[model samples]
Target: MTGTVLVTYGTTNGSTARIAETIEDVLRKAGLTTEVLAARAVASVEPYDAVVVGGGLYAGRWQKDARRFVRRHSRALAERPVWFFSSGPLDASASERDIPPVPAVRRAMTRLGVREHITFGGCLEDGARGRMAGMILRSGKGGDFRDFAAIEAWAAHVADELGRA
Candidate 1:
């Protein structure tokens, strides 16, 4: 397909945004037109042929901006090829195995007929915001756990699927 893809994401400390950019890069490299934007900054999905939405997981829920974005654009998203991803596992679990979406994301996916969903490891560092983040850092759990190789593979898969569609 020769259509543009929008890669939008909600991030707390920017790791999820990085993942979204990574996806955008792969799609572009595969000859697909693409744009990467923060989830909250997206005014509409009507301009894109396909979309990939991602959020940083916190307390078992997607970042507020992501949830709001989905709710706001449900109708448009339902009519298009949409994929979902979550980033927020300050450990190796996400990289080590398949981490399913939280319940709310699952419901949204089913409701919107999302093409696929994935969970990638998250990153938290010294300057991350939030009290909980500070606590996690103090407790020695903060680190960058995102597996770029896995992220690239997933993006490649998305590009392939989009081509077939």
Candidate 2:
């Protein structure tokens, strides 16, 4: 079951990148070889057996780079185990209702028949560039909302799925 997994992410202020690295660690610990790279840095998906794509959310949408990554490799990704995650919904308050996936993401998932999609809370830095964007967005107050336990649990589930495959 051991094989290469690519954990690619698009982050606005680095929260999603951190989440991607955590997933990479989980896969490695499960005896799978993993490479965590920025979504924009991934020129090809041919090197990996499975793909984990992640990104931060802004205005109810995933980062552009993440969307582009999926669009560019949708066919190849459909032939492999693929997981999608979004870093958003700052806290529990924001999670009370189900957030709809962006139109592009929804369409991509249907077209690619992606394996799974998860949404995790995002972190925002006070002085970071994303913070400025958030201010303009009129989103929630800034703070780290990423739940490591939830992230780890999701990663474990992905590993189990890959193992079964």
Tens digits of per-residue lDDT for model 2, 1-165? 667999999887788999999999998888788999999999899989999999789888898889889888888999988888888777764345445566777787788888878888888766558546668446657788788888898899998888887
Number of clashes found in candidate 1: 0
Evaluated at residue 64, the lDDT of candidate 1 is 93
**lDDT per residue (tens digit) for residues 37-77 in model 1:** 99999999999999999999999999999999999999999
TM-score per prediction, in order, is 0.99, 0.90
Model 2: residues with Cα > 4 Å off, grouped in runs: 93-100, 130-140
Worst 10 residues of 1 by lDDT: 1-10
- Model 1, residue 29: distance off in Å is 0.2
TM-score between model 2 and native: 0.90
The lDDT of each candidate is 0.96, 0.84
Compute the lDDT of residue 124 as modeled in candidate 1: 95
Q: What is the lDDT of residue 54 in candidate 2?
A: 92
